[model samples]
Target: MKIISFGVNNFRGITGGLENNTIEFNNSNTIFLLGQNNVGKSSFLKAYEFFYKNTSAAVEDIYRMNPENVIEFELVLQLDEFDFQKDSIANKKEGLKKWLNPDNLLKIKRVLKPKIGAKISFEKTENYTWDYEQNGWVAKNYGGIGLDTVFQAALPTPIFIKAMPTEAEGEAIINEILKQKANANLEDKDRLELKEAQAKIQELQDKLYNPESIQSYKEEVNKYFQSLFPNTKIELSEKDKTKWTENSIGKSFAIHFEQNNNGEKDETIPTSHERIGHGAVRSAIFSLLLMKDVAEEFERVDNRKDYIVLFEEPELFLHPKLMKQLRTLIYKVSETDTPYQVLCASHSPQMIDITKEKSSLVRMTKHNEGTRLFQINDEFLKDSKEIKTKEELKQEMNEILRFNPFICESFYADEVVLIEGPTEEIILRGYFNEVQIDKDIFIVNCGTVNNIPFFQKIFSRFNIKYHVICDSDAAEVKELDNYGLIPFETGIQKSIYQQLKSDYEKVDYSVGLFHVNVPTFEPSHQQESIKDNLKYSNNYLASDGKPYNENLYWKDVLKPNLNSEEINTVPIVKFLKNIVDHN
Candidate 1:
């Protein structure tokens, strides 16, 4: 079953009526919840669980809150066609009576109402009242199936594999399986009993020694060891392997172990589980459970339709490389016969890189009212030109800028000035005022020279007309050249004015630049005062007190030449005047 929509009410941080908050999964089978910490990503998952299983467990607990509290949650799910058809019952509403046909219509109608297939609830207590009325129909009918059974049977069991079993518990489970098989064939009078017993034994043996199973088990063991020793791999001896099976299963099983150290003697004897890291253990359990669930679904062959799998932080406790591998695995799983629809939440940029077009990303933010999930629009996708010309430049920029930083600033303007540092920004503003020009022209302090290429690419992507001003430092000149910005590596002030002169001659929008020369400013008394004022007043300015040069005062030179109230208005007015003169 795929969850189509959900609603939450008085649920911890989410209070009041929040209904019909729908999550539309990709028809192509992928979804993504892309948000930072604590914007209800986990709570959203809990809400889905709560809607299907309306037990009295604190719905608020799904969020970071007290378990005793109660919260109302509702979810809409789209079940497999077969399951829906099988569970559907005739509508029994009083108004539906007139529509019902007398000729066996009751029977047909009885099967027509939406089928309630499986109900699973997580209650706070055994006697807690389950709000069946609020639950999806599937939950209402399947409520008879205990929480454990429903979770095990209906949803994929591997989803909960993170819940670890104690050594004793693992033994008990293995033993129980053996006992069940033993008892089932106990009364067999023929050789069938022998065959069945042999089969059971083989199955258990395969689980122990099968390549995949062994690898998974080994990963789990290593995980436990890593938690105690960070940034280190545990060494396991052949004897240690023996001890693990001896302790976990029994000494009767043939186990192998290998020991290696960081070019040092192997002093520690670690079990397969012990040698493995804790992260591997957690992920292995989850992977194993998910695989098991997939196996079960394959065996049942009941609902062959697409399935939507919502994973909350699948990258949890995984290295970046491993996380990338996990993404590939998820994509592979979706390609199987029973194609899967996957929705995942992640904080890692690696995870973000894995997202494809089919994935729907929602960024969540906290508001005064409550948390809100905002769909990432196409605008967030860097434009085609930006993608083609400077993909690496854009990615690196995004890494440094952080996605949130740009969102906080104003980028909606048509004409923008990109400056290297806060000092330049302040000096330019003051110069603009001195020349009596409107300050409406958007001026962005890009934070650093290294980021200039990135912003330029972004502006080019959006087709925004923008000019960049930066120091003529040797490194800065080289960096700008790498970004296709031809730098005139002379004094900053002369270089900027020279570029402007050349640009005016070219009649091209791209032909504008700004640079500053520091040496000339030392003799000017006013320059020192300007530098001190910029250093003391503007918090965004760099700490180093750099004197401003003529390039910093370009706005003062240009204001009188332009005939508009707004700085951006000057260009538009000039264009209009040229157009009329040409006509």
Candidate 2:
């Protein structure tokens, strides 16, 4: 049971409009939710909880309180027969098969129906729909299964890690693990006896404490008190009568862990490390969730597919090393053979596992109208997958990150500008600091002239506002065509510009030439043309009456140009200013 996509309205902060509205999965299992503060990254996950996991939440609990408000949501699921086997009702398989169309997909919706505004006393209904290749969407007979059963069949057990985590969230999991480990200490016969006694004890415990079981008892007590009192009624609850804590399985079992006293002598301790920090507790829950068996357990129970987890800021309180480790583990778990998927809300770039063939990061933001979610993989980088293999793209991105981690800013920036090489990047970065006030724009060094086109292809594919600034080196391009037309670097630029023009009309570009006869960043003297890559240039005489080298020329030539009030007067920097300003 996996939720492919969902739509919610008038629930919590998601008011449902052109801004905050439907979320389409478009077929991704591991998803990363990215956003700024209060942009609905957390709210979206909470909405999923109420819509899918909180089966007992009433209309009053879910309906957003506002003028003329009503709550409704729909989920589209990619169904599988393997999960349908969990429905032990002999006829459940029949119903599952009947609902599963040729595409193996099912659509369901929850609505409090009554057109009247502010109406809470309306009929709640869950509708199921299927589609045919020719006839389009058709209603299905999910009537046989209750709304609760439909939910079970559609999605997995949702494990959510709240934005504000506490030790309480992980205590139960720890207790269960300790209890299971403790069973190893018992003899076979003793274990069996304990199991039987536990079952009997739980049975009695349920009878005394279960809300349904004690419902009549509470009503009778209220009636008895009401007879003695005129306008008062009794409210009763059932809890442990034992004043002292009972010696239950949990109390009897405990795990003694060795404590490293701040890297000093080790000591065996029985207490928890919860008081130490929030990071430890958050890591504990996350590590347990990544356990192999725990992941496998998320698979369909009794053959019915179901299980999922929502993690908000899983990287909180951890160092970069741990964050990377957790990120890798999450990638492994989400890719397992089980439908157990991991979707996390994260602000840390380290939480992103972009090495996967498929990109899973989804960017979210808030607007005046509502919140918006942009699926980066399906919307922008989808075409790149077809042109380049996953390995190929991963290698390129890894290499990009190796030298300049700042290049990764393109993943989050609203607009991206690609520069040809380090010289251009440095020059522009310095000038940008002096002029560009907008922090949302990014500038990346493309490493080489050839890399500009490659980077532009990706940005264009992603629908990002992209522009390029490259060195023309046109003055030195002496290669001649059959018509005696000299076109070398200029030819390459024309081809790239044409492609950019075709990809986006009115192409935005800025090309700069070295001092008329100069070529690359390393401009040597005219007599030493072959030494253009070297630091020293004989053309400009230094104060010591020596020809200037790359080092001397930078201080003598570059620094002054950069520090000038008219920094934008420089050809390349000026072009960059135009592209960035327009954007």
- Provide the overall lDDT of each model, using Cα atoms, as 2-decimal numbers: 0.41, 0.53
Give the alpha carbon lDDT tens digit for every residue of 1-583 in model 1: 4434445644545443453234554243455565546666666655554444543443334333533333544433333433323222212233323322332121100010111225323433321112333322322332222233322233321121123433333333333323222232233342353354543544443443445543544454445333323334432222223222312432122222244466443547655655555455544333422332222333223332333455667767777667766666555444434345566666654655322444445554454555655443223444412453334535644554562244213333445676766545555655455544432355667676555555554444333455665555542333344324445554443344444444435432343343333322222212433333222223213344453433333334333434433433222223223322321
Looking at candidate 1, what is the lDDT of residue 63? 33
Candidate 2 error regions (>4 Å): 7-10, 15-27, 54-72, 112-128, 131-146, 150-154, 172-258, 261-270, 296-306, 378-388, 457-463, 472-566
What TM-score does model 2 achieve against the real structure?
0.69
Best by lDDT: 2
| CA deviation > 4 Å runs, candidate 1 | 26-30, 59-70, 81-269, 272-276, 289-300, 303-312, 315-319, 335-341, 377-583
For model 2, residues 1-583, the per-residue Cα lDDT tens digits are: 5667767766666664523466666556678887677676776777777766544434444435443555667666765555554444335555555555666666655654434455644444545454434344444435322255644544655667765665555555444432332332234465455566655444333332345523443344333322222233222222224222224633321211223455443434433544344554565455544433333433324433344668889888777876777777666666647455777888888878655643366676555655555565532443543345656667766776676665645766667777666655665565566664664668777776666666665555434556665545663455544432333345446545544555544343222211212354444222242323322344544445322243355455545566455544344544665665663
Query: In model 1, which range of ten residues has the least summed lDDT?
Result: 106-115
Model 1, residue 518: distance off in Å is 26
* TM-scores of the models, in the order given: 0.42, 0.69
